[model samples]
Target: MSETFSDDLIASLPVLRRFALSLCKRGDLADDLVQITAERAFKSRDSYDPATRLDAWLFRILRNAWIDMTRRQKTQGSQIDVVDNPELISIDGRDVVESKISLNQTEEALTNLPDDQRAVLLLVCVEGLSYAEAADTLDVPKGTIMSRLARGRVALAKQLGIKS
Candidate 1:
């Protein structure tokens, strides 16, 4: 069981890093977030309910860690630089460049949206989660998820200059 969990964690690292990157927009911080999440997940392995999706459980940890970091930084008042250590979270350069173009656009548009709408867009559009699954992950009503999804789509369309 321990070996299986270790293997699962290894497999999840890449996706988890991507999700963290989306949250932090910095490679080093995202890598740190993934590392912290892995440590927490390993330490609390027993607390993890097998019935729940492991990815969702991991995401909750990463999100909480990010929130905590942001809160701490409020007092520090200085941004951390993790951009130079790109090797820690290796992304193919060509793919990353292509992704950056779209990500920059999408992320900018996403930032303008309300938090609920941004989360819905990430879960549905980026993470490919179904509306029901997203609602479960977010602990919100399905209708709320749907409304956010609709609003997010409209916002993205307008931001991207789509005449719809």
Candidate 2:
């Protein structure tokens, strides 16, 4: 890989971490997922096409890694520990209490969603991916992405006690 490609990969770390955290819902697990994804991306560097979006490719790789990890955990009959760290809070304003409450509510609602719905919601709504881009990344049809996003939004709204 060239210096530019390496830089691009490095630049995608924050977004990759965010996506992994959204999927795994644990800081430690998300960190491991990101590390594994970086290793895989480096090993498969030659397989990457420069013309394609690097972030999208990385997202796909990370998603696949998370899926594999989940399957392995299921087969092993192992449970993942949920870390109760307050650092996961996303604060948007000066009211710390309100921010924490809202963040917790949103996070809880998100985690309650089915994996497929959560994945699509995070990619399209949170990560700002277009429907077509998300479909390509997930290897699904655009219509599937749309339907999942719709269902996810409605479900999330209901969870948050908001009328859709």
Candidate 3:
């Protein structure tokens, strides 16, 4: 790969990791997904179109990788082990506890959303991808993206007890 490609891949890591974590909900698995994405992107560098946005291309790769990982996990009958998160368990102070609780509540609300809505929320809202870009990354129509995002925002607001 050329230096520019390498630089782009490295620059995309933080967003990739965030997106992976949103999909998998485990730091370790998210890291693995990011690694797999980078590897695949590097090996398939020749297939990338230079005219398109690299971040969207990488997001597409990461989303596909997560799908592939989930399919394999299903075939292998894999399940994530649930345990209390340490941040939520902390008793440092009232402020810290409140902050953790608020954060956890938001995350849990996001988690409860349907897979399609959750993916749309993360891609468009959290990752700052335009509707068209998100649609292209997910290989869906722009109308679909807009609809999902609208529904997701309403659902998320309802989950958080916010009037919309």
* Model 3 accuracy (lDDT, Cα): 0.88
Q: Which ten residues in a row have the lowest lDDT in candidate 3?
A: 78-87
What is the per-residue lDDT of model 1 for residues 1-164, given as tens digits with 9 covering 90 to 100?
Answer: 68988898899999999999999999999999999999989988999887888899999989988886675566567654568665566568999898889879877888998888899999877776667768989999999999999988998889978878
Could you tell me the lDDT of residue 97 within candidate 3?
Answer: 84
lDDT of 2 by residue, 1-164 (tens): 67888899899999999999999999999999999999999988999998999999999999988986785565567444446655655665778878789989999999999999999999877676667769989999999999999999999999999986
Clash pairs (backbone) in predicted model 1 = none
Q: lDDT of each model, Cα atoms only?
A: 0.86, 0.89, 0.88
> Best candidate per lDDT, number?
2
Off by over 4 Å in 3: 78-164
Task: Identify the runs in model 2 with alpha carbons over 4 angstroms from their true place.
Answer: 79-164
Clashes of 2: 0
Misplaced by over 4 Å in model 1 are 79-164
The residue pairs in collision within model 2 are: none
Reference-based lDDT, residue 126, model 2: 69
Model 3 alpha-carbon miss at residue 102, Å: 54
Candidate 3: tens digits of C-alpha lDDT, residues 1-164:
49999998999999999999999999999999999999989988999999999999999999988886775565566444446444445456988989999989989999999999999999877676667768978999999999999999999999999999
Candidate 3 residue pairs that clash: none
